[model samples]
Target: MQSATSPLQTLLDLINETLSLILRTSLTVRSFAGRWQPLRTKLASLQTSVADISDSPHWAENPLLYTLLPNLLSTLQRLKALADQCNDTSFTGGKLHMQSDLDMAAASLTNQLRDLDLLLRSGVLHQSNAIVLSHPGPGSDKENLSFFIRDLFTRLQIGGVEFKKKALESLLQLLEDDDKAATLVAKEGNVAYLIHLLDFHNQPWVREQAASAVSLLAASNDESRKAVFEEGGLGPLLRLLESGTTTLKEKAAIAVEALTADPENAWAVSAYGGVSVLIESIRSGTPATQTHSVGAIRNVADVEEIKAALGEEGAVPVLLQLLLSGTITAQEKSANCLAILASTDEYFRALIIQERGLQRLMHLIQDLLSSETLEHVLRAIASLSASEPCARVLSSSTLFLIQLAEFIKQGNSILQQISVSLLSNLSISISDGNKRAISSCMGSLVKLMESPKPVGLQESASQALVSLLTVRSNRKELVRDEKSVMRLIQMLDPRNEAVSHKFPVMLISAILAGGSQGCRKRLAVAGAHPHLQKLAEMEVAGAKKALQRLSGNRLKTIFSLTWRE
Candidate 1:
């Protein structure tokens, strides 16, 4: 056991002594020149490898290099002894026996050379050159951190099970907050190695850490996500979800979710039969696992084929259960998944209603404080509202209608848009009673139509008003609010290109269909007639129809008479 202070020096001294002994033996015993020749060549190569290692200031700190040094020294000592035997003139052993001993010595030298070459090629020594033992502070040298990450990758490639596990744990720490390092790992193609460890047999802990590392990398950036998918990460991740421990399943679900976030990688999840496993995870996994699994399903369900697969795999029931009982994240994710499914297929929408998914969603919406969860819940309800039967059922809930009206007025822009769209859908089947109740949202809808940006929100608000105004009571609600009616007429102005002329024209037509003279006179006085004439000339839909209805009240005579006045 040489002191670490001079281990390289000691190894170098042993190599020189061996080389000197080999020269003496080669000159003394010309009979074994063939064997000595190759042995000398091997020792020279090993010497060069040692010199390379010595060039790295941190080679002494490399655990693999330090461990190999003592064995290398011992091999040299044995070779020197064998060389001394070959130089002995009065040896009792015959020439043939001496030849065998020389051959054995040559073989030992070849093994040492091979070991040293492997050490150099492992890149461990070079990577150790950049090792920074202390935790990096703010604005530390990112290059050093990059080299340290590469060193861990080298260990993963060649170290034993324990070393690989420690490297994975270290990698997870590095990736925890350092997205740049994760990008580096992906660019270096090390994510494939991490994916390989996910299937490490009989080493659940190793696989756990590997899964965690992959999950972190997948979530880090688009590059890492694409890397994981390209490396076939989804297959092993699915297997973990199928049979791994609770913790492993949770980590694997997270990896799957992140990997599928890139829609390009989503089809592979279903290709690997992940849909059923993820649905089952929602049924039986831990709260965290359920959340991640639901999120993964939501990401993949965007693909039409995956949506059908989720339906066939009976995800609706499990997701509805999760929507009711899982964690807030799980509930949000489940609602989101359900939204995708219900939005795409009419059968899934009906299936969700049959499963009482609507009831659960309506119940969940009441207590949800997270805007994200509420958004998904509203999205789910909005999708279900597209079904006439589901609309009738949803409209029957007074509490639900009140909540929607409030969401229209008070929710964020996205929530406001979704709520408006839901009301628009509900208006098709809404009973006469519900229509009057939902009309309370008309003021907010009119206000939404006034904003110039997010033209889609404005369109959705106007479209809902058109549907609601088909009911006489809703028409009265609009007619009673002069500002609301005036805003619709203002939108009809061709110079106000912020909104299409069609929506405002449609709203006025729905109003005039009630045949209220006061509404017609109000429109005549508000100068709606000229706006409609210009819109009709432009051939905007519904503008001609609104003009005809407004003219039917002899508003043509009123307009001409007012012009003369």
Candidate 2:
């Protein structure tokens, strides 16, 4: 308590003390409303003589605690610095009250920013305005804002928990602006940010939408790819190929598809162990994931390391398991993988066949035939028939034979054609195993021959039946049994090329091979014994003539009444 001083000096000292308090409160970057209006009133009373002092360059810093002018960029910086401080734990721990203060300050500062933005747009002030936006330079330009934004983004990227979250939210919001949005999210830069979101974000919607945005932003840009690698985006994506949520995993896979189109990215994906993940995903993921993952792997399947990695991953067992468990799309992809292996690795092909791969393929074909999923069934069958071991695998299934018979019983000409082709291949390359398989399917083959249809199918049918006669156990039962002799003779009537060419050759071969057991007895009882004897005598008497007549081509055309002219 010193002696009383002059009234103006008291007021000046009081104002200086209040400014000290102002400095302290702002050190934590929080606003203080206590006595704010009263102080403002007091400061306003004293500003009459403060006019010339305000024109100083530093006047914008403060006017003895009556800081005004929303256009002052300093105030905006102060607000942002406060947000950063609040985000930092150490800065806010001793200052819980700072958050509310910041909220208030931010609200006020935001209003001022809006006003300043309007003023800048209107060009009403002495300062350079939005026109200055058209041509950017070093000082006091939009370029500074760009640099500031980029710095904020970088800080957020490597920042701690709270700070990083705030940084992301702020940056995301800023991107909603049209002009400011383009500054950073140029097509290429967006890719980096988006890949990071896929790699790091735990929110599904966030990851999904960010990935979608990335898709649009990267639509044509060849740049920004380096940003993806620098952010460690590839490894996380491969890992995500397994564990991410449905939507996120899909987006991540699509992103991988886009990035891996470039050779370097394909290598990058492989180097990150993507092949194993993708192959395993075929077994464990949803049908859609399996499909997409297969496609992803196919993109790099030509790479030796990627292919070797897939093999080492025990993909065959998983693929087999998927054949037992997966959806149609998964089955398609599994078939494709098998095709790749069959063409590229003989040992792998042998391994799959040894594991009853052909049995499963045959079973799948039957199911597809039943379901009328023809394209996939054909593909699976094609995959099977291309290899010898696959044929061995083919002989193991009795259920397959039953289904083939039913397929022919349906009397679908196409099904008959396929069955004939399959049986012919089997009979032509006869093995003990194949005979057993044909025994299973022979009933179905006999049923197909009994039905009536186009002449073209008869020749293949005859050839197939004749080959069956080569097996002694099946001969008398098939040839002489149940009015089959009449069908066989009618099939060779020369009205249809198929029957004409195939039936006689096969019939003559069967009779010669037969040499009159139950077939001769049955034909004698059926009253065709003389006809057969004559045919046999004719063949014996004119061997070369018989051969030439058999060799002459027969062309018969059968038109369906099923379709209208």
Best by TM-score: 1
Worst lDDT 10-window in candidate 2: 550-559
Alpha-carbon RMSD, candidate 1: 6.2
TM-score of each: 0.76, 0.45
Model 2 lDDT on a 0 to 1 scale: 0.51
After superposition, the stretches of candidate 2 with alpha carbons farther than 4 Å from their true spots are 1-204, 212-239, 242-246, 254-272, 286-288, 294-305, 354-393, 405-421, 428-465, 471-565
Q: Which residue pairs in candidate 2 collide?
A: 459-498
Candidate 1 residues 1-565, lDDT tens each?
A: 3334466667666666666665566566535666777777777777688778777656766665444666667777777776776667665678788777767767766766766675566565665453332334447676766666667776666456766777777787778867677787787537777888888656877878888888887888888888888998999999999899888898888888898888778888778988899988888899989999999998987688888888788988998888778888888888888888888788888999999888888988789558988998888888888777777788788789889888998899888888887777666566677667777889889989887766477777877787778787777667778888778778889999777777788788888988988878888788899999999999998888889999886856778899999
**lDDT, each prediction:** 0.78, 0.51
Q: By summed lDDT, which 10 consecutive residues of candidate 1 come out lowest?
A: 128-137
lDDT for 427 (candidate 2): 54
**132-208, model 2: which lDDT tens digit per residue?**
21222335355545543443343334334444455455545444433434334452133465567766776665565
